[model samples]
Target: MDVTYPSSLALALFSITLVLALFVRSLRSKKTKGQLPPGPKGWPIIGNLFQMVMNRPTHEWFHRVMADMQTEIACFRFARVHVVVVTSSEIAREVLREKDEALANRAEAYSIDLISHGYHGISFSAYGEGWKLSKKVMVTKLMSPTTLNNTLVSRTMEADNIVTYIFNLCQSGSMKKPINVRDATLTYSHAVMMRMMFGQRHFDEPAEDGGLGPKEKEHMDAIYRALDCLFGFSVADYLPFLRGWNIEGEEEEVRGAVDIINKCNDPMIRERMHLWREKGGKEKEEDWLDIVITLKDDQGMPLLTFEEIRAFCKDVNVATIDNTMNNVEWTIAEMLNHPDILKKALDELDTIVGKDRLVQESDLCKLNYIKACSRETFRLHPPNAFLPPHGAREDTTLAGYFIPKGSQILVSRPGLGRNRKMWSEPDAYKPERHLDDYSRDSMGVSMLEPDMRFVIFSTGRRGCPGTKIGATMIIMLLARLLQGFDWSLPPGASQVELVANNSNLFMAKPLLASAKPRLAPGLYPKIQV
Candidate 1:
C-alpha cells in the first residue's frame, strides 16, 4: 500500500505548487493592491499560523512584529483567516468608536461557543438585540451600583481576612522571609469575588471533607484552562478545511474544561433556585446568584436560562478576580522595584489614611496617589496585552485601509500603553501624570471609558461589565496593603521582573517580596467579624 515518489520529484512538485500558489496570490493581490495593510508574507496553506502558534504567546510576539513593520495597523493571513492588528490609540478609537457597530462581534472560537452555551453569554455573543438584552441585564441588574453597594460589607470582610492572614504570618515570625504576594493576592481577590457572587467565602478555606475548598481550586484551574484554550491559536479554527482533524487536541480539552465548569456551577444555580422557591420568592436577593435566579426579563420570563446563568457566573468570577489580582500584584511589584515610588505611596497613605486603622473602601476616594499608582500599573501591564478578538460585521474601512467582512481585528493594548507618540517617556513608571488631572474623576472618567488611552477593560459596547467592581477591588486591596505594611524586595533582590515571560498572559513572574508590619501592634489584630 506504500507508494513513494523520488526525492527529486517530491521537491520539484513542492516547488511547482508553491509557485502556483504565489501566482494565484498575486492575481488576488492585484485586485486589492494598495487597499490591504502591509504585513508579513506567509506560506501558501499555513500562512502565519506557524509564526503565531509557534511563538509562546501571540500578543507579545505580535507587538514585536508590529514594531518591526513600523506600521500602526498590520494585516496578515493566518491560515485562511484575515487578521488586522491596530497598534495606535488613534486606530483603536476608529475601530472601537467610529466603526464599533460594524466591528462589534468577537471572532468565533469553538471553545468560547461551548462555554457560552452557543453564544448565549454577553462576552462572545454577536451584536444584536439578544446581545443588548444580555448586556443590559448584566450591567443594570447584576452589577449596578446598588448591587455593588450591597456587597461592600462582604468585600471589606474579605479584605480584612487578607490582613488577618498576613498579621498571623508576621506573628509567627515570617516577616523577614519573602512571602508569595501573588498567591496572597489570588486568595484575597477570589475570596472577595466569591463572597459577592455566592454570599460565601468559605471556599478559600481548608475543610475536613475537603469541602468547597477543593472544588473552588478545581473551578479556578478549569477557568484558567478554558481561557488558555479559548484564546490559544488553533489551525482548524482558521483553516476551515481542517475542522475535522483536531490538529492540536483543542476540541477535547475545551469540552472537558466546559464540563468541569458546568459540573461545578450547575448545582450552585439549582440551590439558589430551590432556595428562592422554598421561600415563596420572598428571600432577600443576597448575592448575584440569588438575583439571577429570581429576576425576570422584559418578556416576564427568567432573565437567564440555567445554562446562561452558569456561563454568566463563570464570566463574572474570572473577569473580576483575574484582573484585580494581577493589577494588585503588578502594582505592588512596581512599588517594590522603585523605592521612591513606594515611599510616595506610603507617604500618601500616612497623610490621608493615617496608620490608626486599616484602609476602608470608603477611603479609596481620598487616596488619590494610591489610585494613580494602580492606574499606572494598569497602563504598564494590562490584563491582556491585546484586546479580545473582534470580528467585522461587514466590509469596513479602518484607518484608510479596507477590511473585508468577518476579518478578525485585534487592538494592541500593550502598544497603546507604551505608545511613544502618545506618552512622553512611555516606558518609564511615573504615576504623577495621572495625578495632574483629578477633574477627569468628577466627569466619571476611568480606564473603562473610551477617552482613556488605556483599553484594558476594552471599549465600546462589549466593554467589561464588571468594571466598577474590578476597579474597586484593585484600589481597595492596594490601599490596604500599602497602609498596613512596608513592603520591599527580599534582601539583595533589587528589581522586580517587568518583562512578561512566555508562560502567562499578563504577569511574567511570581512576585516574591518581604512584608513588615507598619501599623501599631494593636492595629495588626484581626477584625472580629
Candidate 2:
C-alpha cells in the first residue's frame, strides 16, 4: 500500500512503509514465539533497525510506539540486543536508581570502541577501575569548587569577552545577524575548559599571537573530527565479525580523524608527565592533566598509560564542553525569546547583585530565582534529551518485571520532563515554581527543588559529574548577558521554535537562531559577582 506522492519526504516515507510491510509479514509468519514488548514491526533480517537508524528523533518515535501499543514499557530488539524503553518515572528510577549497580553500565557499540580510542573515556567505558579512576580524577580535581573559584578570573574574562563581542556585533548595526549561538557557545566552553585543564586557550588572540596559535587550532580541529567520527555509522559496528561493508573511504576517514585526536593530546599529556617528574617526589600540581598523569594505584604505580592519558584529554574535551556550551547558548536563547522569563531573571539579578557586579558561583546559591531558571531551562531544553544507554548487566526484575541481561535500557528525559502527570503546566516556562516562596504559591509554577524525576542531568551514581559546573556556567553567562544588554529575537525570526537537533540519545544540539542585542556599553563588564 505504498502511495506514490511526488515528494522526497513522501518517497522516503514509502521506503519506511515498505520496510514496515516486510516486518509485518515476518511477524505473522513467526507468531509461535512468546510476547515481546510492543514496537513497530519491521523487515525480517534487519527487524526495525533501518527505520530506527534513519529517524533522527528516536525518542519521539519511541513515544509514538508506546502510545500506539498502550504500554508503559516496550522492548525493541536489534539483532542480539534488546533495547527496553521505559516510559514512566517509577520504572526509570527502578532501573537507574534502585538497582543501579547492574544498570549503570554503558552499552558500548563496536564503532564507539573504535572512535573512543578503544573505549578509554568515562562516558562510554565499561564499569571498572578505569571508569572509577577517571571519574574520580575529573570530579575531585578538574571540576571541584576550588578549581572553579581559583579560575574565576579566566571564566570572568570569557564572560567579559561574550559581552564585548555582542556589543561590537551590535555596534556594527548587525541587529538582524545570524549569530549562531552554537558556535559562540562552543567557543566559550572550549576556552573555559582548555584554560582550566591545560592553562592554555585559543580565543581572542593578540596581534603578536596572530589570532590563536597553531596548537589551539589543531586541538579544536582534532576534537571536532573525533566527535564527527565518534557518531559515524561504521559497518564494523553492525557486524563486527563479518565487517559488513565499510563505506567507500570510511576506513581512511576514521583513521585520519582518530589520528588527529590522538596527536593533539600526546604533547600535552607528555608535558604534564614531565612537569610532574621534575617535582622531586613532592606533591605535583592538582590540575586535571596533572592528576591523571600522576594517579597511582595502591602499589604507587601509574594507573593509566600514555595512550589512556591522551584518550582522557579527549574525553574531557567532549563531555565537559559539548553540553555546557549548548546549555548556556540555549538558556540565552530561551531567556531572550521569552520576555516574561527575561523580566523575571532581570528582576532577580537586580535585586541581589543590583547592577553592581556580574553573577558568579558565589551568587549561585543566594539567587534562588536564577537557580530555578537554570533548572527550568534544563528541564525544557535538556542538553541531552536522553542519557547514553545504561546497559542491563544482569538478569534482574525491575519494577517487579523481568529484564534480561544485555538489554539496552533507555531513560527518556523528554517523556518524563514533559509528562503532564508528572509536572503541572508542563508546557509553560516558569522558574518561580522551583522557588520556596510559598508566598508566590498561586502562580502555578512547578518547583524543581531536589527532584530527579525530570532527570536532566540524570540520577544515581552514573549521573553526569559536571552537572553543577555546566549549569552554573549557564546561570552566570545568562545573568551576565542580561546585565549588559537587553535582547530580542531578530525581525521575522523572532518566533523560531527551540527545537532539538540531537546528535544522539546522549547529545542535545540546539537549532540555529538570529537575534539582536540592544544594550549600552560598560553595562556587563562588571564581574565581581
Candidate 3:
C-alpha cells in the first residue's frame, strides 16, 4: 500500500510539470531567414542567438566568424532578422561618409523602441524630418562653443565637488580602494549634461537629498538596462509572428525597462514645463529646454509635446553623455598602462598648463602630448565598438553585393581602431602615432581633429555633432586628474592583464584600475604658453 501511494504521487508531479513545460514551449515558434542575409548556422527557433551571447566582448566571437568566413563583412540570421557584421574602414566610409545621406537612417528595432520610448529620440530614430530637425538643433544651437563653455562652467563646479568627495573618501578609508571609474565618470557627466539640457545635472544632491533619489536611481537603472539590452539578438525582434518569445528574459526585461524609464523621466518633464510657464522670460535663455520651449515659430503648430522633449533630454543624457565620460576613463587607464606615454603627456601639460593654473581651451594647441594621449586612448578603447546601425534609405551595393533597403549598415569602429592595415602596432598603446608633424600636417588640421581612421566620434552627417566639446571635456578631465595625481595600477594589480571588460554599460569602461592618490600642489594649473 505504501509503495503504490508513493508511485502515484510521483506520477502526478511529473504529469503536472510536463503539462506546464509544454504550455511554455508552445509560446514560441521559429521563423525562417529566407532572403535576409548570410551568416552562421544555428539551432532551430533560437537561431544564432545563444552562441553570439554566451561569451563577453560579443564582438570578438563575431570577429572570429568573420575570420573563418574570409569575409570583411557578413550577415547573421537571428530568427528572421538580418544582422550585418562590417569589418573594413573603406566600407565604413562608404556607409558613414560618401553615401551617408542614403544611409543616415536607423533600423527600427523593438528593444530600442521600448528603451527609448517608441524610438522617439534622435540617436535611434528612423531617418526622417523629426530626427533631422532635432539633430540640427543640437549641432547648431545646443552644442555650440558658447553653450559648451556655459556647460563647462557647470562641469568645473561639479569637478570641484568631485575633488572634495575624493579627498573626503581618502580621509576616511584607504586611498588605494579602487572605485568603479564608470560610476564616478557617470556622476561627472550626468551633472554636465543635466546642466546643459535642463540647467541642472541631477534632480537632487545625493549627499544631501540622497544620490539621484531612489526613484531617480531606479529610473537611471532602467535607462542603463535599456542601454545594456538595446543591442543584441532578441527572439521577439525577429519572430514577430510569435509575439511572445521570452528567450533569455529579453522580452520581459525590455517591457519592464520601458515602464521604468517613463516613470522616471515623465514627471520631471511635466514639472519643468510648468516652471517654464511660471517664469515667463527667455524660455531658452540658458538651456536646450528653454530653446525648444521658446520657439514661437514651430510652424504655428504645437512645436514639441512633452513626449518629444523627454526624448530630446534622453538623447543627450543617455546617448552622448556617458560616451564622453567613458572615453575619459579609458584614456586614463591606457595612460596608466604606458608610463612613457604618461610622462610625455605630463611634461607637455606642465609646459602649457604649468603647476598652478588649470587647462584652458586656448592651451589645447600647445599641449601636443596630452592631445596624442587622447587619440591613443581612443585607439585603444573606442566608446562604441560598433557604430549605431544605419538603415539604407534606398537600395545600394558594395563590393558587387546588394544591400537592399532596410539592410543595417554599421561602421566597425572597434575593429577599425585595431586594424593593422590602418594602424601600426595596433594593440600597443602609443600616442606618438599622431605626433608626426607630417602626420598632423597631412591630416590638414590642428591637434583638434584626430586621425580619421580612428573614428571614435564617427564622421559625416551622423558623426557625433558634439565631437569637439566631447574631446575637450576628456582632455580637460585627464589633464586635471594627471596634474592632481600620478595615477598607477593599485598594489599587486596585473598591469598587463588589466583590460577594460566593461561590455555591460552604455559605454565600455576599464573593469579593473587600482591606484592611490599622488596629490600635487595644483590641479589643472595655469598653462604657461
The number of the candidate with the highest TM-score is 1
Report every candidate's CA lDDT.
Answer: 0.74, 0.63, 0.62
The digit string of per-residue lDDT tens for model 1 on 367-448 reads 7777788878878877666777889888889889988887899887767888888888888889888877567448322445
Question: Mind giving the per-residue lDDT tens digits that candidate 2 earns over 1-529?
Answer: 0112134543544464466556555563433124455667765554555566555345667778888887767877554566778767877877777888898678765446656667786777888887887788778876787876777877777777666665555566556665656655665666667766766665334313112346555666656655544444332344344242443234555567667656666677776777776545336454567767777779988877876877677777777665565556667777766778878877877787776555665665666666677667666666554667788777776555567776678777766767777779987777666664334445322223234557656657677777776666666666666666666665576554765554433224443555444444555443211
Tens digit per residue, CA lDDT, model 3, 284-352: 477777766654444765466776777777776566555666666777766766778778878877777
- Between candidates 2 and 3, which one is better according to TM-score? 3
lDDT of 1 at 235: 57
Best by lDDT: 1
Error of 1 at 346 (Å): 0.8
Would you list the rank order by TM-score, best first? 1, 3, 2
Clashes of each: 0, 3, 17
The lDDT of model 3 is: 0.62
TM-score of 3: 0.82
Worst 10 residues of 2 by lDDT: 1-10
